[model samples]
Target chain A: MTAHPLHVPPGPVDLDAIATDATPGYGGSKSDGKAALEGLGPELADLQERLFAEGRATGSRRRVLLVLQGMDTSGKGGTLRHTVGLVDPQGVRISSFKAPTADELAHDFLWRIRRAVPAPGYLGVFDRSHYEDVLIARVNELAAPEEIERRYDAINEFERELVEDGTVVLKCLLHISKDEQRERLLARLDNPEKYWKYEPGDIDARARWDDYRAAYELALERTNTAHAPWHVVPSDRKWFRNLAVGTLLLDALRGLDLGWPAADFDVDAERARLLASEAST
Target chain B: MTAHPLHVPPGPVDLDAIATDATPGYGGSKSDGKAALEGLGPELADLQERLFAEGRATGSRRRVLLVLQGMDTSGKGGTLRHTVGLVDPQGVRISSFKAPTADELAHDFLWRIRRAVPAPGYLGVFDRSHYEDVLIARVNELAAPEEIERRYDAINEFERELVEDGTVVLKCLLHISKDEQRERLLARLDNPEKYWKYEPGDIDARARWDDYRAAYELALERTNTAHAPWHVVPSDRKWFRNLAVGTLLLDALRGLDLGWPAADFDVDAERARLLASEAST
Candidate 1:
């Protein structure tokens, strides 16, 4: 219920103003942060199960959507592996958006995203979500400037509809420095195990870092809503990033005030039926 | 690859003949088995990443399909939580099939099953699969006797096509006894946290335990092939069940002989470009 320290406040957004290595709310060594994340498993799992139960038993539409956006190698994949991995996979619905296909391009940008929305009682995660329409689409001049302007309003309205329909949208921008990204890209090229992650086009994107940052600043400012606030996650330190995101998710779930759904069937009757059936067997 | 001890051999599979509490391959205490499963994390994660990388880099059709079929509360969901949870969720596509809708029923049973198959380089998991058509349909006469008879061959052919097209189907029958089912169902009833899982219909299914067992025995025998053999996992103990399924998945991934996919681009040239870009910035 309290304000999250990492929540991007309403203002003119500046990517350069925030330090990427700052562990804003958490004060711990890497091991301490890791252990804290591990400790959160039980509570997070229980709350998630309760949410899942509420949806199934009562057909409640309440759900959570975690939208992750960042530059290449900003640890979207790592966030999924460590932080999001804490909950039961069955309760999570993850969709990674790549370049749109022919069919996707033919329709509105939100067309594909709508199809991937989490069903009732799911923790939906979008890695490189519809934000791409404004980010990459803006940086590359893939769409007209006026059209790009229109999309910001379109996205805000779409997200508002989701919130009204019992969805909690948690948007996180995995903020990292250019220096950190350079190091990570080099490391990927250095290690054979990580080589599969490196693509030449990543350099092309990196070259336009300033343009991407400007694009992000505009997008974050234009689309930042009270209902679906964006959190700028400082992701230079992997451990802290995971801890922050995990805490953010934990807080969002706690806000829901989820509890075990009450039994719909008569407990005594079910018990009697079970015993009678056992005896007959 | 060495033969897995829990694999059902080519012959009649007597559900009564197999002891439900037996932990055939695991030689450890509950904590030890849990630790052993945990020990598999790094290796399992690496292999899964490689499988995912191969799919992305080369457009390789090689994939895995882990089909889990069992009575309710047979630890299918547990296996997913503890075992499949070890892998990167990005690479794992899980589909849990419930009762078919009017649209689903209008088509062949395999039609829905086919739509949920894993894409290239994915670890696909089905909580309950097409085998349900034979199991439940046969038990309740949901289909005509002749139609149920025809589905056995249809399933075999469908699976064979998946295998031939580069899917390694790992079918697991989570074997548990009638007594075990009663205890599990009772546990669900007693615990408020688990009450959501206790449907009254589960008792009805338990009442016809013998018929369900017979259905499983025949289904396993008819569909078991060299390419996709059934592993009868003794799932009475939750810890051992998690370990056995983890080991099965690890062995299946190891059998793929996966490695870091070769870089599709010139690494040195990209590295040079990266450094040059950094200098410009």
Candidate 2:
């Protein structure tokens, strides 16, 4: 196995030195990788059904969230369309965090993210999540150095609460090279079909790439917790990125002690009544 | 024309007297209605494009919000799937408000709603919106009667601000009969497939049907402002319901003076450069 381990355990790590293209745990060909990704769909769907069913039936509410943080054109949307797309849209809650609105900026940063967090049985995907506070806010000097430092602790406490309340939190930092980003942005500008996806401000973000990277490094080191560890996925290869995320979801789901809630109703009587009604109608 | 009118202009309306199956503006057969719905897709698509485009371009940032309020099984989800379904999902933002969390309940009712209103160039749908404050809160006596009264004015003022800020606010109350709701609930109970969608708490809501109706009547009469009027939708018939909302959305879209934004970039130069870059790559 070429060691591109995607999951970073709660510990000290240097994001600056991590290879964005490393596929440490993947030992498969591109064909095998794609096949593996496709294969996980059924398991995910089944797990989601059980989770959703459980939430409806009982007091214990189980939820899963994937928090995605990345640079411009780092395949967040692609991951959404491919990985989360496999689940029932009804069971999935996707909250894409754009630049905060004036109203949102007035409140705490997590206010919007907290509202959008998946309810029990939902598989939530944060397209660009609360990590923006640390990444963008830090890089742009939007907040003071000390205040930026304080966000790391606040985020950890929040995730701890989510985990305590039965929500599995998996954060992924999509690590892509600046060169790859330039190519992607150029592709967007070049393709008329993709012009809608382009924003002139993305170029502004791109200009602050190094500063953003430094900010990300600090975020990963400071906030990554045992409860909500950050996984820096090598995202230069889009295929590998999807496969890695899909596998992580599959593992998290399968690890849960999950089952369908037993139906409390008299099914035979209900079924008979429905049949009688249908005949009468 | 089998007239099934969709829009309810701002006015005093009696919820008790309002027909749950009134389709005065819809004069078509089922097949005709479905076709008209299918037919509106492209124009809705076009209007949505212009709305979304206008937002992305400089200066003018127009938007729309369709707030759906109804009793349990009144087909809010169906409307979302069928009516809002016609537009590009990318251009649509759907916020399904559930029971507020401890954190949310701590704040004012409109806090979460204000956060979820669509950005410029987006058509936002509230699957069960702030009206819950007045409906459920009033029906359950969750707040003091005086406090409940305050929310109506608060909602109107909140909505007025949204209108003043360039969002076309359309509120729809999907009015389904108590008899119709009973049938829907029984259907869910009878069919195993629908058991997931059936919440046990719905029966409790069903029990308070009259109270809820009274609450709805008061809400409709009080908050039906010229700025953000409430339309009582005849949702007992699903197809008519879908068609009515679709037509309402189409009319709202057409009502807007929208056009594709002129390109801000040097299109010819950008295109030529993209073409040249493609050749080199």
User: What overall lDDT goes with each candidate model?
Assistant: 0.88, 0.78
Question: Model 2, range B1-281, lDDT digits (tens) per residue?
Answer: 43344455555666656677767676778898888888888888789877877776647757999988998899988787677766655567778898898989999998988889888888888889999999999988888999998999998899889999999998888988877877887887766656766665676676677788788878887888888877778888888888888878888899997765665676566545433432210
| lDDT winner | 1
Residue A14 of model 2: what lDDT?
Answer: 66
Instruction: Give per-residue CA lDDT, model 1, range A83-102, as digits (tens).
Output: 77888998888888999999
- Pairs of residues at least 3 apart in sequence or in different chains that clash in candidate 1: none
Steric collisions counted per model: 0, 16
TM-score for chain B considered on its own, for each of the candidates: 0.96, 0.94
Q: Pick the candidate with the highest DockQ.
A: 1
Residue B185's lDDT within candidate 1 is: 84
Question: Candidate 1 DockQ score?
Answer: 0.60
